[model samples]
Target: MNYILSIMPSLFAGAKMTLILFFWTLITAIPLGIIVSLGLLSYFKPLRLVLKFYIWIMRGTPLLLQLIFIFYGLPIVGIIFQRYDAALFAFILNYTAYFAEIFRGGFQSIPIGQYESARVLRLNYWQTLTHIIIPQVSKIVIPSIGNEVINLVKDTSLVYVIGLGELLRAGNVATARDVTLIPLVIVGIIYLLMTGIASFLLKKIERNFAKWK
Candidate 1:
Protein backbone atom coordinates (compact mmCIF):
# COMPACT_ATOMS: atom_id res chain seq x y z
CA MET A 1 0.00 0.00 0.00
CA ASN A 2 2.81 2.39 0.91
CA TYR A 3 4.66 1.54 -2.27
CA ILE A 4 1.54 2.12 -4.35
CA LEU A 5 1.06 5.50 -2.78
CA SER A 6 4.69 6.38 -3.33
CA ILE A 7 4.50 5.54 -7.03
CA MET A 8 1.28 7.36 -7.72
CA PRO A 9 2.85 10.58 -8.90
CA SER A 10 5.05 8.92 -11.50
CA LEU A 11 2.19 6.78 -12.66
CA PHE A 12 -0.08 9.78 -13.04
CA ALA A 13 2.55 11.71 -14.91
CA GLY A 14 3.04 8.79 -17.27
CA ALA A 15 -0.71 8.47 -17.75
CA LYS A 16 -0.87 12.15 -18.69
CA MET A 17 1.66 11.56 -21.45
CA THR A 18 -0.33 8.58 -22.62
CA LEU A 19 -3.51 10.63 -22.82
CA ILE A 20 -1.74 13.40 -24.68
CA LEU A 21 -0.61 10.94 -27.32
CA PHE A 22 -4.03 9.35 -27.60
CA PHE A 23 -5.98 12.59 -27.98
CA TRP A 24 -3.63 14.26 -30.43
CA THR A 25 -3.36 11.12 -32.51
CA LEU A 26 -7.12 10.74 -32.71
CA ILE A 27 -7.74 14.42 -33.40
CA THR A 28 -5.26 14.65 -36.23
CA ALA A 29 -5.63 11.17 -37.68
CA ILE A 30 -9.36 11.39 -38.32
CA PRO A 31 -9.17 14.34 -40.70
CA LEU A 32 -6.13 12.95 -42.46
CA GLY A 33 -7.89 9.63 -42.75
CA ILE A 34 -10.85 11.30 -44.41
CA ILE A 35 -8.57 12.90 -46.97
CA VAL A 36 -6.84 9.61 -47.62
CA SER A 37 -10.16 7.92 -48.05
CA LEU A 38 -11.11 10.51 -50.61
CA GLY A 39 -7.86 9.86 -52.41
CA LEU A 40 -8.58 6.14 -52.37
CA LEU A 41 -11.93 6.80 -54.00
CA SER A 42 -10.66 9.39 -56.44
CA TYR A 43 -11.08 9.00 -60.22
CA PHE A 44 -7.36 9.48 -60.82
CA LYS A 45 -5.90 6.03 -61.21
CA PRO A 46 -2.35 6.95 -60.18
CA LEU A 47 -3.51 8.67 -57.02
CA ARG A 48 -5.76 5.79 -56.05
CA LEU A 49 -3.02 3.26 -56.62
CA VAL A 50 -0.54 5.27 -54.59
CA LEU A 51 -2.92 5.78 -51.71
CA LYS A 52 -3.86 2.12 -51.73
CA PHE A 53 -0.20 1.08 -51.58
CA TYR A 54 0.46 3.48 -48.77
CA ILE A 55 -2.47 2.10 -46.80
CA TRP A 56 -1.32 -1.43 -47.50
CA ILE A 57 2.17 -0.75 -46.18
CA MET A 58 0.91 0.98 -43.07
CA ARG A 59 -1.56 -1.78 -42.25
CA GLY A 60 0.87 -4.57 -43.02
CA THR A 61 3.65 -3.45 -40.68
CA PRO A 62 3.63 -3.40 -36.89
CA LEU A 63 3.26 0.07 -35.39
CA LEU A 64 6.21 -0.54 -33.08
CA LEU A 65 8.47 -0.93 -36.06
CA GLN A 66 7.05 2.25 -37.54
CA LEU A 67 7.75 4.07 -34.27
CA ILE A 68 11.31 2.78 -34.18
CA PHE A 69 11.85 3.84 -37.76
CA ILE A 70 10.43 7.30 -37.28
CA PHE A 71 12.39 7.93 -34.07
CA TYR A 72 15.67 6.24 -34.93
CA GLY A 73 15.72 5.71 -38.64
CA LEU A 74 14.80 9.29 -39.50
CA PRO A 75 17.66 10.63 -37.39
CA ILE A 76 20.10 8.63 -39.47
CA VAL A 77 18.88 10.57 -42.50
CA GLY A 78 19.28 13.90 -40.67
CA ILE A 79 15.57 14.36 -39.92
CA ILE A 80 15.39 14.28 -36.17
CA PHE A 81 12.44 14.65 -33.82
CA GLN A 82 11.98 14.82 -30.08
CA ARG A 83 10.73 11.64 -28.44
CA TYR A 84 7.14 12.82 -28.13
CA ASP A 85 7.09 14.26 -31.63
CA ALA A 86 8.41 11.04 -33.15
CA ALA A 87 5.89 8.92 -31.29
CA LEU A 88 3.02 11.24 -32.21
CA PHE A 89 4.07 11.32 -35.85
CA ALA A 90 4.29 7.58 -36.15
CA PHE A 91 0.99 7.07 -34.35
CA ILE A 92 -0.93 9.57 -36.47
CA LEU A 93 0.40 8.18 -39.72
CA ASN A 94 -0.18 4.58 -38.72
CA TYR A 95 -3.67 5.15 -37.42
CA THR A 96 -4.57 7.40 -40.35
CA ALA A 97 -4.09 4.46 -42.67
CA TYR A 98 -6.31 2.30 -40.54
CA PHE A 99 -8.98 4.94 -40.14
CA ALA A 100 -8.82 5.75 -43.86
CA GLU A 101 -9.48 2.13 -44.68
CA ILE A 102 -12.35 2.07 -42.22
CA PHE A 103 -13.82 5.23 -43.66
CA ARG A 104 -13.36 3.91 -47.19
CA GLY A 105 -15.21 0.75 -46.32
CA GLY A 106 -18.00 2.80 -44.84
CA PHE A 107 -18.12 5.02 -47.92
CA GLN A 108 -18.19 2.06 -50.31
CA SER A 109 -20.94 0.37 -48.36
CA ILE A 110 -23.29 3.16 -49.40
CA PRO A 111 -25.26 2.10 -52.49
CA ILE A 112 -24.75 3.80 -55.87
CA GLY A 113 -28.49 4.41 -56.02
CA GLN A 114 -28.17 6.87 -53.17
CA TYR A 115 -25.80 8.99 -55.28
CA GLU A 116 -28.13 8.71 -58.24
CA SER A 117 -31.04 9.77 -56.10
CA ALA A 118 -29.05 12.74 -54.82
CA ARG A 119 -28.22 13.75 -58.41
CA VAL A 120 -31.86 13.43 -59.43
CA LEU A 121 -32.70 15.78 -56.57
CA ARG A 122 -30.16 18.23 -58.11
CA LEU A 123 -27.73 18.18 -55.20
CA ASN A 124 -24.21 19.29 -55.99
CA TYR A 125 -21.28 16.99 -55.10
CA TRP A 126 -20.52 18.80 -51.87
CA GLN A 127 -24.18 19.02 -50.92
CA THR A 128 -24.73 15.39 -51.72
CA LEU A 129 -21.76 14.39 -49.55
CA THR A 130 -22.68 16.70 -46.69
CA HIS A 131 -26.39 15.96 -46.69
CA ILE A 132 -26.56 12.34 -47.71
CA ILE A 133 -23.21 10.55 -47.72
CA ILE A 134 -21.47 11.69 -44.54
CA PRO A 135 -24.35 11.02 -42.17
CA GLN A 136 -24.76 7.49 -43.36
CA VAL A 137 -21.03 6.83 -43.38
CA SER A 138 -20.78 8.13 -39.85
CA LYS A 139 -23.41 5.65 -38.74
CA ILE A 140 -21.70 2.77 -40.51
CA VAL A 141 -18.24 3.60 -39.17
CA ILE A 142 -19.02 4.46 -35.54
CA PRO A 143 -18.61 0.99 -34.08
CA SER A 144 -15.42 0.37 -36.04
CA ILE A 145 -14.08 3.75 -35.04
CA GLY A 146 -14.90 3.02 -31.41
CA ASN A 147 -12.89 -0.16 -31.58
CA GLU A 148 -9.99 1.73 -33.13
CA VAL A 149 -10.16 4.33 -30.39
CA ILE A 150 -9.87 1.63 -27.76
CA ASN A 151 -6.98 0.10 -29.65
CA LEU A 152 -5.28 3.50 -29.72
CA VAL A 153 -5.47 3.60 -25.93
CA LYS A 154 -3.58 0.35 -25.71
CA ASP A 155 -1.22 1.21 -28.54
CA THR A 156 0.03 4.24 -26.61
CA SER A 157 1.99 1.80 -24.49
CA LEU A 158 4.14 0.99 -27.52
CA VAL A 159 5.71 4.44 -27.18
CA TYR A 160 7.82 2.87 -24.47
CA VAL A 161 9.73 1.06 -27.20
CA ILE A 162 11.07 4.43 -28.25
CA GLY A 163 12.00 5.23 -24.63
CA LEU A 164 9.09 7.61 -24.09
CA GLY A 165 7.89 7.46 -20.46
CA GLU A 166 4.26 6.57 -21.10
CA LEU A 167 1.99 4.62 -18.71
CA LEU A 168 3.41 1.17 -19.26
CA ARG A 169 6.93 2.50 -18.97
CA ALA A 170 6.10 3.96 -15.60
CA GLY A 171 4.78 0.64 -14.43
CA ASN A 172 7.87 -1.10 -15.75
CA VAL A 173 10.13 1.29 -13.90
CA ALA A 174 8.30 0.77 -10.63
CA THR A 175 8.20 -3.00 -11.06
CA ALA A 176 11.93 -3.17 -11.72
CA ARG A 177 12.74 -0.90 -8.79
CA ASP A 178 10.50 -2.58 -6.23
CA VAL A 179 10.59 -6.11 -7.64
CA THR A 180 6.79 -6.40 -7.40
CA LEU A 181 3.92 -6.55 -9.88
CA ILE A 182 1.67 -4.16 -7.97
CA PRO A 183 2.55 -1.25 -10.20
CA LEU A 184 1.63 -3.25 -13.28
CA VAL A 185 -1.71 -4.19 -11.70
CA ILE A 186 -2.43 -0.56 -10.95
CA VAL A 187 -1.52 0.43 -14.50
CA GLY A 188 -3.93 -2.15 -15.83
CA ILE A 189 -6.69 -0.66 -13.70
CA ILE A 190 -5.89 2.80 -15.02
CA TYR A 191 -6.13 1.55 -18.62
CA LEU A 192 -9.45 -0.12 -17.87
CA LEU A 193 -10.80 3.13 -16.46
CA MET A 194 -9.70 5.06 -19.50
CA THR A 195 -11.22 2.58 -21.94
CA GLY A 196 -14.40 2.35 -19.90
CA ILE A 197 -14.93 6.10 -20.13
CA ALA A 198 -14.25 6.01 -23.85
CA SER A 199 -16.66 3.13 -24.35
CA PHE A 200 -19.41 4.93 -22.46
CA LEU A 201 -18.97 8.10 -24.47
CA LEU A 202 -18.85 6.21 -27.78
CA LYS A 203 -22.02 4.37 -26.86
CA LYS A 204 -23.77 7.67 -26.33
CA ILE A 205 -22.59 8.93 -29.70
CA GLU A 206 -23.73 5.69 -31.27
CA ARG A 207 -27.16 6.15 -29.74
CA ASN A 208 -27.41 9.69 -31.03
CA PHE A 209 -26.59 8.49 -34.54
CA ALA A 210 -28.98 5.57 -34.19
CA LYS A 211 -31.87 7.97 -34.74
CA TRP A 212 -30.75 8.29 -38.35
CA LYS A 213 -31.18 4.58 -38.98
Candidate 2:
Protein backbone atom coordinates (compact mmCIF):
# COMPACT_ATOMS: atom_id res chain seq x y z
CA MET A 1 0.00 0.00 0.00
CA ASN A 2 1.10 3.61 -0.50
CA TYR A 3 0.82 4.24 3.25
CA ILE A 4 3.27 1.47 4.02
CA LEU A 5 5.66 2.69 1.35
CA SER A 6 5.77 6.24 2.73
CA ILE A 7 6.96 5.13 6.19
CA MET A 8 9.31 2.36 5.10
CA PRO A 9 12.44 4.48 5.40
CA SER A 10 11.74 5.63 8.97
CA LEU A 11 10.88 2.10 9.98
CA PHE A 12 14.07 0.74 8.46
CA ALA A 13 16.12 3.43 10.18
CA GLY A 14 14.62 2.39 13.49
CA ALA A 15 15.39 -1.20 12.65
CA LYS A 16 19.01 -0.28 12.14
CA MET A 17 19.19 1.33 15.56
CA THR A 18 17.50 -1.68 17.11
CA LEU A 19 20.02 -4.03 15.53
CA ILE A 20 22.93 -1.88 16.70
CA LEU A 21 21.73 -1.90 20.28
CA PHE A 22 20.96 -5.62 20.31
CA PHE A 23 24.20 -6.73 18.65
CA TRP A 24 26.49 -4.53 20.72
CA THR A 25 24.77 -5.46 23.95
CA LEU A 26 25.26 -9.17 23.24
CA ILE A 27 28.81 -8.73 21.96
CA THR A 28 29.86 -6.95 25.16
CA ALA A 29 27.58 -8.58 27.71
CA ILE A 30 28.47 -12.23 27.03
CA PRO A 31 32.17 -11.98 27.87
CA LEU A 32 31.51 -9.67 30.79
CA GLY A 33 28.95 -12.17 32.04
CA ILE A 34 31.49 -14.98 31.82
CA ILE A 35 33.97 -12.96 33.88
CA VAL A 36 31.42 -12.12 36.54
CA SER A 37 30.28 -15.73 36.68
CA LEU A 38 33.86 -16.82 37.16
CA GLY A 39 34.29 -14.27 39.91
CA LEU A 40 31.22 -15.51 41.77
CA LEU A 41 32.55 -19.05 41.46
CA SER A 42 35.97 -18.10 42.80
CA TYR A 43 37.43 -19.58 45.96
CA PHE A 44 38.17 -16.12 47.31
CA LYS A 45 35.47 -15.22 49.80
CA PRO A 46 35.53 -11.47 49.21
CA LEU A 47 35.53 -11.78 45.47
CA ARG A 48 32.64 -14.21 45.45
CA LEU A 49 30.62 -12.04 47.79
CA VAL A 50 31.30 -8.88 45.78
CA LEU A 51 30.31 -10.48 42.50
CA LYS A 52 27.18 -11.93 44.05
CA PHE A 53 26.18 -8.54 45.38
CA TYR A 54 26.75 -6.92 42.02
CA ILE A 55 24.54 -9.46 40.30
CA TRP A 56 21.82 -9.05 42.93
CA ILE A 57 21.79 -5.28 42.53
CA MET A 58 21.65 -5.34 38.75
CA ARG A 59 18.96 -8.04 38.63
CA GLY A 60 16.93 -6.40 41.36
CA THR A 61 16.54 -2.94 39.78
CA PRO A 62 14.39 -2.08 36.77
CA LEU A 63 16.33 -1.68 33.55
CA LEU A 64 14.64 1.61 32.70
CA LEU A 65 15.47 3.05 36.09
CA GLN A 66 19.03 1.90 35.69
CA LEU A 67 19.20 3.61 32.29
CA ILE A 68 17.83 6.88 33.66
CA PHE A 69 20.24 6.83 36.59
CA ILE A 70 23.19 6.22 34.33
CA PHE A 71 22.20 8.96 31.90
CA TYR A 72 20.75 11.59 34.27
CA GLY A 73 22.46 10.86 37.56
CA LEU A 74 25.98 9.96 36.53
CA PRO A 75 26.65 13.45 35.18
CA ILE A 76 26.42 14.74 38.74
CA VAL A 77 29.29 12.45 39.64
CA GLY A 78 31.48 13.68 36.74
CA ILE A 79 30.94 10.53 34.71
CA ILE A 80 29.07 11.79 31.75
CA PHE A 81 28.49 9.84 28.53
CA GLN A 82 26.38 10.59 25.50
CA ARG A 83 22.78 9.39 25.67
CA TYR A 84 23.26 6.40 23.33
CA ASP A 85 26.53 5.46 24.98
CA ALA A 86 24.95 5.74 28.41
CA ALA A 87 22.09 3.53 27.30
CA LEU A 88 24.57 1.02 25.91
CA PHE A 89 26.53 1.04 29.14
CA ALA A 90 23.45 0.54 31.27
CA PHE A 91 22.20 -2.31 29.05
CA ILE A 92 25.56 -4.04 29.10
CA LEU A 93 25.84 -3.86 32.87
CA ASN A 94 22.29 -4.97 33.42
CA TYR A 95 22.51 -7.83 30.95
CA THR A 96 25.91 -8.90 32.26
CA ALA A 97 24.41 -9.50 35.66
CA TYR A 98 21.62 -11.60 34.21
CA PHE A 99 23.86 -13.57 31.85
CA ALA A 100 26.34 -14.11 34.66
CA GLU A 101 23.65 -15.75 36.73
CA ILE A 102 22.73 -17.98 33.82
CA PHE A 103 26.35 -18.92 33.29
CA ARG A 104 26.81 -19.63 36.99
CA GLY A 105 23.86 -21.98 36.95
CA GLY A 106 25.32 -23.76 33.94
CA PHE A 107 28.68 -24.09 35.64
CA GLN A 108 27.11 -25.44 38.82
CA SER A 109 25.28 -28.11 36.86
CA ILE A 110 28.62 -29.77 36.13
CA PRO A 111 29.42 -32.59 38.56
CA ILE A 112 32.09 -32.42 41.24
CA GLY A 113 33.37 -35.79 40.02
CA GLN A 114 34.47 -34.14 36.78
CA TYR A 115 36.74 -31.77 38.68
CA GLU A 116 38.22 -34.65 40.65
CA SER A 117 38.83 -36.62 37.47
CA ALA A 118 40.55 -33.61 35.94
CA ARG A 119 42.75 -33.35 39.04
CA VAL A 120 43.68 -37.01 38.82
CA LEU A 121 44.71 -36.42 35.20
CA ARG A 122 47.14 -33.76 36.46
CA LEU A 123 45.23 -30.93 34.87
CA ASN A 124 45.64 -27.60 36.63
CA TYR A 125 42.62 -25.48 37.58
CA TRP A 126 42.87 -23.39 34.43
CA GLN A 127 43.25 -26.36 32.12
CA THR A 128 40.47 -28.26 33.81
CA LEU A 129 38.19 -25.25 33.53
CA THR A 130 39.04 -24.57 29.91
CA HIS A 131 38.85 -28.14 28.71
CA ILE A 132 36.41 -29.94 30.98
CA ILE A 133 34.17 -27.35 32.57
CA ILE A 134 33.66 -24.82 29.82
CA PRO A 135 32.56 -27.36 27.22
CA GLN A 136 29.83 -28.80 29.40
CA VAL A 137 28.71 -25.44 30.72
CA SER A 138 28.40 -24.10 27.20
CA LYS A 139 25.71 -26.65 26.49
CA ILE A 140 23.59 -25.81 29.51
CA VAL A 141 24.10 -22.09 29.01
CA ILE A 142 23.36 -21.97 25.31
CA PRO A 143 19.57 -22.13 25.68
CA SER A 144 19.58 -19.43 28.33
CA ILE A 145 21.94 -17.27 26.34
CA GLY A 146 19.69 -17.66 23.34
CA ASN A 147 16.69 -16.53 25.31
CA GLU A 148 18.55 -13.48 26.57
CA VAL A 149 19.61 -12.57 23.06
CA ILE A 150 16.01 -12.54 21.95
CA ASN A 151 15.13 -10.42 24.96
CA LEU A 152 17.85 -7.95 24.11
CA VAL A 153 16.33 -7.55 20.66
CA LYS A 154 13.00 -6.55 22.14
CA ASP A 155 14.59 -4.38 24.81
CA THR A 156 16.16 -2.20 22.14
CA SER A 157 12.90 -0.26 21.97
CA LEU A 158 13.45 0.82 25.56
CA VAL A 159 16.42 2.93 24.52
CA TYR A 160 14.01 5.44 23.07
CA VAL A 161 13.55 6.88 26.55
CA ILE A 162 17.18 7.99 26.45
CA GLY A 163 16.73 9.73 23.09
CA LEU A 164 18.35 6.94 21.12
CA GLY A 165 16.06 7.45 18.08
CA GLU A 166 15.37 3.75 17.79
CA LEU A 167 12.40 2.04 16.14
CA LEU A 168 9.88 2.95 18.81
CA ARG A 169 11.03 6.57 18.79
CA ALA A 170 10.63 6.76 15.04
CA GLY A 171 7.13 5.41 15.34
CA ASN A 172 6.35 8.05 17.94
CA VAL A 173 7.62 10.79 15.69
CA ALA A 174 5.46 9.48 12.88
CA THR A 175 2.42 9.33 15.12
CA ALA A 176 2.82 12.96 16.16
CA ARG A 177 2.65 14.11 12.60
CA ASP A 178 -0.75 12.39 12.13
CA VAL A 179 0.69 10.16 9.45
CA THR A 180 -0.83 6.74 8.91
CA LEU A 181 -0.28 4.24 11.71
CA ILE A 182 1.68 2.28 9.11
CA PRO A 183 4.95 3.35 10.72
CA LEU A 184 4.13 1.62 14.01
CA VAL A 185 2.95 -1.48 12.21
CA ILE A 186 6.11 -1.55 10.17
CA VAL A 187 8.19 -1.25 13.30
CA GLY A 188 6.43 -4.27 14.75
CA ILE A 189 7.05 -6.25 11.58
CA ILE A 190 10.71 -5.30 11.63
CA TYR A 191 11.06 -6.49 15.20
CA LEU A 192 9.20 -9.68 14.48
CA LEU A 193 11.43 -10.38 11.48
CA MET A 194 14.59 -9.62 13.39
CA THR A 195 13.57 -11.80 16.30
CA GLY A 196 12.61 -14.61 13.94
CA ILE A 197 15.99 -14.54 12.27
CA ALA A 198 17.76 -14.47 15.62
CA SER A 199 15.70 -17.32 16.91
CA PHE A 200 16.56 -19.42 13.90
CA LEU A 201 20.29 -18.79 14.30
CA LEU A 202 20.27 -19.46 18.03
CA LYS A 203 18.37 -22.67 17.52
CA LYS A 204 21.02 -23.78 15.07
CA ILE A 205 23.76 -22.89 17.55
CA GLU A 206 21.98 -24.82 20.26
CA ARG A 207 21.73 -27.88 18.06
CA ASN A 208 25.38 -27.67 17.14
CA PHE A 209 26.43 -27.43 20.77
CA ALA A 210 23.94 -30.05 21.85
CA LYS A 211 25.73 -32.62 19.71
CA TRP A 212 28.82 -32.50 21.95
CA LYS A 213 26.77 -33.54 24.91
Candidate 3:
Protein backbone atom coordinates (compact mmCIF):
# COMPACT_ATOMS: atom_id res chain seq x y z
CA MET A 1 0.00 0.00 0.00
CA ASN A 2 2.77 2.41 0.90
CA TYR A 3 4.59 1.63 -2.32
CA ILE A 4 1.47 2.30 -4.30
CA LEU A 5 0.84 5.56 -2.50
CA SER A 6 4.40 6.72 -3.06
CA ILE A 7 4.09 6.07 -6.77
CA MET A 8 0.80 7.93 -7.13
CA PRO A 9 2.24 11.36 -7.74
CA SER A 10 4.37 10.36 -10.72
CA LEU A 11 1.56 8.32 -12.20
CA PHE A 12 -0.95 11.12 -11.78
CA ALA A 13 1.35 13.68 -13.33
CA GLY A 14 1.93 11.43 -16.29
CA ALA A 15 -1.79 10.80 -16.63
CA LYS A 16 -2.36 14.54 -16.62
CA MET A 17 -0.02 15.02 -19.56
CA THR A 18 -1.64 12.14 -21.40
CA LEU A 19 -5.12 13.55 -20.83
CA ILE A 20 -4.07 17.03 -21.96
CA LEU A 21 -2.75 15.72 -25.25
CA PHE A 22 -5.88 13.68 -25.81
CA PHE A 23 -8.27 16.55 -25.04
CA TRP A 24 -6.66 19.24 -27.18
CA THR A 25 -6.16 16.93 -30.14
CA LEU A 26 -9.76 15.79 -30.00
CA ILE A 27 -11.13 19.30 -29.58
CA THR A 28 -9.21 20.63 -32.57
CA ALA A 29 -9.35 17.60 -34.85
CA ILE A 30 -13.10 17.09 -35.16
CA PRO A 31 -13.92 20.67 -36.20
CA LEU A 32 -11.00 20.94 -38.61
CA GLY A 33 -12.08 17.59 -40.01
CA ILE A 34 -15.49 19.01 -40.80
CA ILE A 35 -13.90 21.76 -42.90
CA VAL A 36 -11.65 19.33 -44.69
CA SER A 37 -14.54 16.99 -45.43
CA LEU A 38 -16.48 19.92 -46.88
CA GLY A 39 -13.50 20.67 -49.05
CA LEU A 40 -13.57 17.08 -50.26
CA LEU A 41 -17.15 17.58 -51.36
CA SER A 42 -16.63 21.04 -52.83
CA TYR A 43 -17.43 21.87 -56.45
CA PHE A 44 -14.19 23.84 -56.67
CA LYS A 45 -12.04 21.35 -58.50
CA PRO A 46 -8.67 22.72 -57.43
CA LEU A 47 -9.68 22.87 -53.79
CA ARG A 48 -11.00 19.33 -53.92
CA LEU A 49 -7.77 18.10 -55.48
CA VAL A 50 -5.65 19.84 -52.90
CA LEU A 51 -7.68 18.49 -49.99
CA LYS A 52 -7.61 15.00 -51.47
CA PHE A 53 -3.84 15.07 -51.78
CA TYR A 54 -3.45 16.39 -48.27
CA ILE A 55 -5.71 13.69 -46.88
CA TRP A 56 -3.86 11.03 -48.80
CA ILE A 57 -0.53 12.13 -47.38
CA MET A 58 -1.73 12.21 -43.82
CA ARG A 59 -3.64 8.96 -44.05
CA GLY A 60 -0.83 7.17 -45.86
CA THR A 61 1.86 7.93 -43.29
CA PRO A 62 2.22 6.23 -39.92
CA LEU A 63 1.46 8.62 -37.07
CA LEU A 64 4.67 7.64 -35.24
CA LEU A 65 6.66 8.57 -38.31
CA GLN A 66 4.81 11.85 -38.55
CA LEU A 67 5.61 12.58 -34.91
CA ILE A 68 9.27 11.86 -35.46
CA PHE A 69 9.35 13.98 -38.61
CA ILE A 70 7.62 16.90 -36.97
CA PHE A 71 9.88 16.77 -33.94
CA TYR A 72 13.23 15.90 -35.49
CA GLY A 73 13.29 16.42 -39.25
CA LEU A 74 11.48 19.75 -39.35
CA PRO A 75 14.24 21.39 -37.33
CA ILE A 76 16.63 20.80 -40.23
CA VAL A 77 14.72 23.42 -42.18
CA GLY A 78 14.18 25.60 -39.09
CA ILE A 79 10.63 24.52 -38.30
CA ILE A 80 10.82 23.69 -34.64
CA PHE A 81 8.29 22.82 -32.00
CA GLN A 82 8.65 21.84 -28.37
CA ARG A 83 8.25 18.13 -27.70
CA TYR A 84 4.68 18.45 -26.41
CA ASP A 85 3.71 20.80 -29.21
CA ALA A 86 5.13 18.49 -31.83
CA ALA A 87 3.21 15.56 -30.44
CA LEU A 88 0.01 17.60 -30.28
CA PHE A 89 0.51 18.88 -33.80
CA ALA A 90 1.15 15.43 -35.18
CA PHE A 91 -1.84 13.96 -33.38
CA ILE A 92 -4.19 16.72 -34.48
CA LEU A 93 -3.00 16.60 -38.06
CA ASN A 94 -3.25 12.83 -38.30
CA TYR A 95 -6.57 12.47 -36.53
CA THR A 96 -8.03 15.33 -38.52
CA ALA A 97 -7.43 13.39 -41.71
CA TYR A 98 -9.13 10.30 -40.28
CA PHE A 99 -12.06 12.24 -38.90
CA ALA A 100 -12.36 14.06 -42.19
CA GLU A 101 -12.66 10.74 -43.94
CA ILE A 102 -15.28 9.64 -41.45
CA PHE A 103 -17.26 12.82 -41.91
CA ARG A 104 -16.95 12.55 -45.66
CA GLY A 105 -18.41 9.07 -45.45
CA GLY A 106 -21.23 10.40 -43.31
CA PHE A 107 -21.91 13.22 -45.73
CA GLN A 108 -21.97 10.78 -48.63
CA SER A 109 -24.40 8.52 -46.78
CA ILE A 110 -27.03 11.23 -46.79
CA PRO A 111 -29.53 10.64 -49.58
CA ILE A 112 -29.42 12.90 -52.62
CA GLY A 113 -33.18 13.40 -52.30
CA GLN A 114 -32.59 15.24 -49.04
CA TYR A 115 -30.40 17.81 -50.75
CA GLU A 116 -32.99 18.26 -53.50
CA SER A 117 -35.66 18.61 -50.88
CA ALA A 118 -33.66 21.31 -49.16
CA ARG A 119 -33.36 23.09 -52.50
CA VAL A 120 -37.05 22.77 -53.09
CA LEU A 121 -37.62 24.37 -49.70
CA ARG A 122 -35.34 27.23 -50.83
CA LEU A 123 -32.76 26.39 -48.20
CA ASN A 124 -29.31 27.85 -48.75
CA TYR A 125 -26.31 25.58 -48.40
CA TRP A 126 -25.41 26.83 -44.95
CA GLN A 127 -29.03 26.64 -43.79
CA THR A 128 -29.47 23.16 -45.15
CA LEU A 129 -26.27 21.98 -43.49
CA THR A 130 -26.99 23.55 -40.15
CA HIS A 131 -30.64 22.63 -39.99
CA ILE A 132 -30.85 19.20 -41.52
CA ILE A 133 -27.58 17.75 -42.75
CA ILE A 134 -25.50 18.21 -39.63
CA PRO A 135 -28.01 16.61 -37.31
CA GLN A 136 -28.18 13.44 -39.36
CA VAL A 137 -24.46 13.31 -39.95
CA SER A 138 -23.85 13.69 -36.26
CA LYS A 139 -25.91 10.60 -35.61
CA ILE A 140 -24.56 8.68 -38.59
CA VAL A 141 -20.92 9.09 -37.62
CA ILE A 142 -21.23 8.63 -33.87
CA PRO A 143 -19.92 5.04 -33.84
CA SER A 144 -16.91 5.84 -35.99
CA ILE A 145 -16.14 8.95 -33.97
CA GLY A 146 -16.43 6.95 -30.76
CA ASN A 147 -13.90 4.44 -32.03
CA GLU A 148 -11.45 7.20 -32.82
CA VAL A 149 -11.86 8.74 -29.41
CA ILE A 150 -10.98 5.45 -27.73
CA ASN A 151 -8.01 5.02 -30.02
CA LEU A 152 -6.81 8.48 -29.07
CA VAL A 153 -6.76 7.41 -25.45
CA LYS A 154 -4.34 4.57 -26.24
CA ASP A 155 -2.38 6.64 -28.74
CA THR A 156 -1.43 9.07 -26.02
CA SER A 157 1.14 6.54 -24.86
CA LEU A 158 3.02 7.00 -28.14
CA VAL A 159 4.15 10.36 -26.84
CA TYR A 160 6.68 8.41 -24.78
CA VAL A 161 8.92 8.14 -27.87
CA ILE A 162 9.53 11.89 -27.81
CA GLY A 163 10.66 11.64 -24.14
CA LEU A 164 7.51 13.13 -22.78
CA GLY A 165 6.75 11.44 -19.47
CA GLU A 166 3.26 10.25 -20.20
CA LEU A 167 1.51 7.36 -18.45
CA LEU A 168 3.40 4.41 -19.88
CA ARG A 169 6.73 6.11 -19.43
CA ALA A 170 5.90 6.80 -15.85
CA GLY A 171 5.12 3.15 -15.35
CA ASN A 172 8.36 2.14 -17.04
CA VAL A 173 10.28 4.33 -14.64
CA ALA A 174 8.64 2.78 -11.60
CA THR A 175 9.06 -0.73 -12.91
CA ALA A 176 12.73 -0.21 -13.69
CA ARG A 177 13.41 1.45 -10.37
CA ASP A 178 11.56 -1.05 -8.23
CA VAL A 179 12.31 -4.06 -10.41
CA THR A 180 8.75 -5.27 -10.24
CA LEU A 181 5.92 -5.69 -12.70
CA ILE A 182 3.37 -4.12 -10.36
CA PRO A 183 3.85 -0.70 -11.88
CA LEU A 184 3.24 -2.02 -15.37
CA VAL A 185 0.15 -3.80 -14.16
CA ILE A 186 -1.13 -0.57 -12.67
CA VAL A 187 -0.41 1.25 -15.89
CA GLY A 188 -2.40 -1.27 -17.86
CA ILE A 189 -5.28 -0.89 -15.47
CA ILE A 190 -5.16 2.88 -15.84
CA TYR A 191 -5.23 2.59 -19.58
CA LEU A 192 -8.16 0.24 -19.42
CA LEU A 193 -10.01 2.62 -17.14
CA MET A 194 -9.38 5.54 -19.46
CA THR A 195 -10.67 3.64 -22.47
CA GLY A 196 -13.60 2.32 -20.48
CA ILE A 197 -14.62 5.82 -19.43
CA ALA A 198 -14.33 7.05 -22.98
CA SER A 199 -16.47 4.16 -24.18
CA PHE A 200 -19.16 4.85 -21.64
CA LEU A 201 -19.43 8.52 -22.48
CA LEU A 202 -19.45 7.86 -26.20
CA LYS A 203 -22.17 5.26 -25.82
CA LYS A 204 -24.30 7.65 -23.80
CA ILE A 205 -23.93 10.30 -26.48
CA GLU A 206 -24.75 7.75 -29.15
CA ARG A 207 -27.88 6.75 -27.28
CA ASN A 208 -28.95 10.38 -26.98
CA PHE A 209 -28.48 10.81 -30.68
CA ALA A 210 -30.46 7.67 -31.29
CA LYS A 211 -33.28 9.16 -29.31
CA TRP A 212 -33.14 12.24 -31.48
CA LYS A 213 -33.37 10.04 -34.53
lDDT of each: 0.95, 0.88, 0.94
Candidate 1 residue lDDT tens string, 51-161:
989898899999999999999999999999999999999999999999999999999999999999999999999999988998899899999999999999999999999
Give the per-residue lDDT digits (tens) of candidate 2, residues 6-38: 777887788888888888899999989988898
Q: What clash pairs does model 3 have?
A: none
Residue 206 local lDDT, model 1 = 96
Candidate 2 wrongly placed segments (more than 4 Å): none
Ranking, TM-score, top scorer first: 3, 1, 2
- Residue 57 of model 1: what lDDT? 88
Off by over 4 Å in 3: none
**Which regions of candidate 1 are displaced past 4 Å?**
none
By summed lDDT, the worst window of 10 consecutive residues in model 1 runs over 204-213
Give the Å shift of residue 98 in candidate 3: 0.2
Each model's TM-score? 0.96, 0.94, 0.97
- Model 2 Cα RMSD, 1 decimal: 1.4
Q: Candidate 2 — which pairs collide?
A: none
